[model samples]
Target: MKKNLIKPIVAAALFGIATQSALAADRGTPREARELFDQAVKFMEANTPEKAFAAFNDRKGRFVRKDMYVFVIDDKGVYHASGAAPEALVGLTVLNTTDAAGNPLFRQMIDSTRSAPEATVRYMWLNRVTNKVEPKVTYVHKVGDYVLGVGYSAPRASADDARGMLTRAVDLVKKDGAAKAAASFNDRQGAFVKDDLYVFMVNMDSGKFEAMGMNPALSDTDARGLHDAEGHALVAEMIDKLKSAEDATVEYVWRNPVTNRVEKKRSYVHRVGNSLVGVGHYIE
Candidate 1:
């Protein structure tokens, strides 16, 4: 009886693991998602709003078709172009509207874009049609006196994509059974680690890793949470560190209070005007 029970339990466990692996394989990676986003950005930048709007509305735009609505907002938060009839939304205002979940989406977009001019702001919105809240990623830029906003939407994944990427990375490390694999993975993804710690560095401008080979699980904190706390500060630090040194590296770590882990991380800061920019742990 014990042997029979163990067989079935083991089979079930294997089946579950196989299913999870298959699902992860099918889903898009963070890098893939970012590349797709870059393609959309390139499309918009290369074309006028009218042209981009039409392309996004067209059925051939697979990115728009697979994800959420595509739309643009001006600096003041007015809809300039929409996947829907652009003419209808040309001058409509969204600054006052709450997202499906009642959050002030417009204000958040403005603030984020203003703070990180080159970075995109990702948020969640309730899709009234699906009655589900999905993730929305928007890249905003100043075009003349108005801000050009281009966005793509997708159902939010269970684990934030950044955390998922980190987890996948850890899995890769475990699978390879080598420390070098961690550094290799980070290098491939443009991330870096400081020595043997979990703290990692990622370049904000190029969105790559500056230091490679670090532990990923030390902090017990998700990327989004870290971003909330020290994303801006980290960016500033990177910029300041870049002034005197063209090829400079900095070491850092993050303490995860919940897990009581101290992550080892590294950073290579770069100068961005009077500010410092580069990537490292999301913490300050």
Candidate 2:
């Protein structure tokens, strides 16, 4: 099942297609989803839709692993095959199909085929294995007129993700130079900011802000004496860390802008010349 169909019961009645009703099982991992997608793509590349469909729908086939399975749709939203879903759904048009979150999952998937070679989209869907509505991260790759997709349950954000974003920002700074990188990072709609993850920088020697991903107004301000809710001197700590170590992590109680709640946060700061550049993620 590709999460939730817009009208499961109506489709079943009209087309005799029952795609979402299945036995509950363990959750699928992202790695398994990627592997299944690769295999299905290989099958498609071999110009064997019939064989690919067979492998996708076969209950005992390699493609049907745990809660992960393959599904294919043409650019027109016509289903060719649905692994782990009702076989009768093969020829039906899923143009109006939406996820549990009311997102036009299939329509967006098909439309994306025209714009990019591959793209990933997220929507709320019924996890047939868990029998619960959970967020799914689907990877879609366009092959000819068809879009091959496989998705896994999305995981929660973590500190490692925050560090990776900042590391990439540091690279951009080195490549694009500080002024250009600062402009990019300051853009809230830019790549440096996603979810609760964002990049910030300060002059380690002087504690003056060079850039702040979510708060551009704070840039160029002296924040050396800033402290968290628990009175942990955050900016001062970053300067000290950069003085002794190449890179370091600082933990303190800070407000999560999304939840508007004070929570524990861990920030990973890396020394980029005279600037202490970093990003932080809230933790439970």
Candidate 3:
């Protein structure tokens, strides 16, 4: 090969390598997003406002990690810094801005911060790596006159994933007991709760909730009273199907906790002694 040709070839190879690296760069987890948020919080608490905002606004700074980035907004709902797109978002009033799902996210942040020092909000946002809108869960903290946030996109679970979770949950119940398994199922941050998929159990005798992974507050409640968006008696249907069969699959319109929308969902239920254990997945 000629010397000039060799130089251009090497340059093109380096460019290709760089592009691949960019594509392979981001795919952050919820744990990493929370860690980055905590680090940014400490940085803000230790440094002056001017220094802290500058660090947050720096896309090349430590505040920006993988797909997670620090974003700050004043109490008035004006953007102070946005590491993701500072040029387009900073210095703008985004209180009225909504997600693709029509969720009033900015106003929700302000309202949430008003009553509590910190909270988590979910909304649909475009994932740069996937070039698609997915479920985004953000951790926001109220500090002085500003609210700082960091978010990461979480993927939805498939029907097979739900079945797998249900199998593990049933195994846990068999290995340990219903009481122990119920405790694990009710744990929101535990293995039972994954993105939009969670395990729930019902007392077949009394028709009461034994465990509700996505919403523990529903535990001990009357499962029979639970109805879907279209007023379908989903739990009653499940119980009726379980009377003659070992397993039951019921479909209904339920609100997805992650997406906060009414979508078609199907739950797989099975008998574990007196309790019925189940896991559900959204159809679309």
Candidate 4:
């Protein structure tokens, strides 16, 4: 009886490990992607073009990890190798091709490699596992006549992250004053801009945006004219809520700055004196 139980326990442990590996295989973080990208570069450096392409084209090779895969493009915007789908994508001239968000990705990559040895670009790409487009950040390195690159999409920020960021932004406004806080909030590299989350503030009376974290150009835009992708007057509704409520959670459809896709967004708005400060997180 003890021996039977031991076999069952060992089998269960093996099953658990297999399950964990399966879960881990479909998802990868930016750090992991960068590490793999570095390893791929080293592999290419150590081997000839024939051997390097063979390793990259291998589906089960080390170059392919989780959702992260390696791709190589020539300066003329032609694909020489793609770890994900070599048969269909390799040898394709994609100079004019654009990403899901209409970003001229290959052209931009070519342009970037000409000026810098390495560069990073963020754009929307299809996550094969999710079958949906998500924001992807790729790091490209110029190697000989080919530009090798690797990218991974990050998980969108949760509702909790938005609320926590809002709390901090609110505290900053209360402590440092609105004018100073708006500057920090408008900084693209600032604390408020993370994943698919950002902070935007509006003047309740004027209904003009004072700060927009993702794009400061949207600042001074009339909030009343703002509408969601579905043409819902969401900003006007937010202003109406501020009339009576100290805090409100408004749901709307807005374009995610990271993914550049119109996605469901929920904003936690708080009335700070005459100004209304808000932070929104995209629903994944």
Q: How many backbone clashes does candidate 1 have?
A: 18
Off by over 4 Å in 4: 1-52, 55-68, 71-151
Between prediction 2 and prediction 3, the one with superior lDDT is 3
Candidate number achieving the greatest lDDT relative to the actual structure: 3
Candidate 1: Cα lDDT at 90:
52
lDDT of each: 0.46, 0.77, 0.84, 0.80
What is every candidate's alpha-carbon RMSD to the true fold?
A: 16.6, 14.5, 9.6, 11.9
Which residue pairs in model 4 clash with each other?
A: none
The digit string of per-residue lDDT tens for model 4 on 167-233 reads: 9999998998888999998998888887677888998898999899988988889987888888889
Tens digits of per-residue lDDT for model 1, 1-284: 87778656533321122223233333233444456556666777787877765665553455443233345677788866554344445566777666555777777776666756556665665332343455555666554444555454444322233344445444444465334443554453344232122324443444344333334432223222233223334433444456566435555455432122354445443332222222333221
lDDT of 2 at 32: 72
Worst 10 residues of 3 by lDDT: 10-19
Q: Runs in model 1 with CA error above 4 Å?
A: 1-32, 84-90, 127-130, 134-139, 143-284
lDDT of 1 at 135: 55
Write the number of the candidate with greater lDDT, choosing between 1 and 4.
Answer: 4
What lDDT tens digits, residue by residue, belong to model 2 across residues 1-284?
55576466545432222234445355566667777788778888786777777777786787777777788888788888776554556787888878776889989887776788888877777666555565677889888778989887653357678877988988987888777888888899888877567889888777888898768999999879888888889989889978989899899887765434587988998988888888898875
Off by over 4 Å in 3: 1-57, 60-154
Clashes of 2: 1
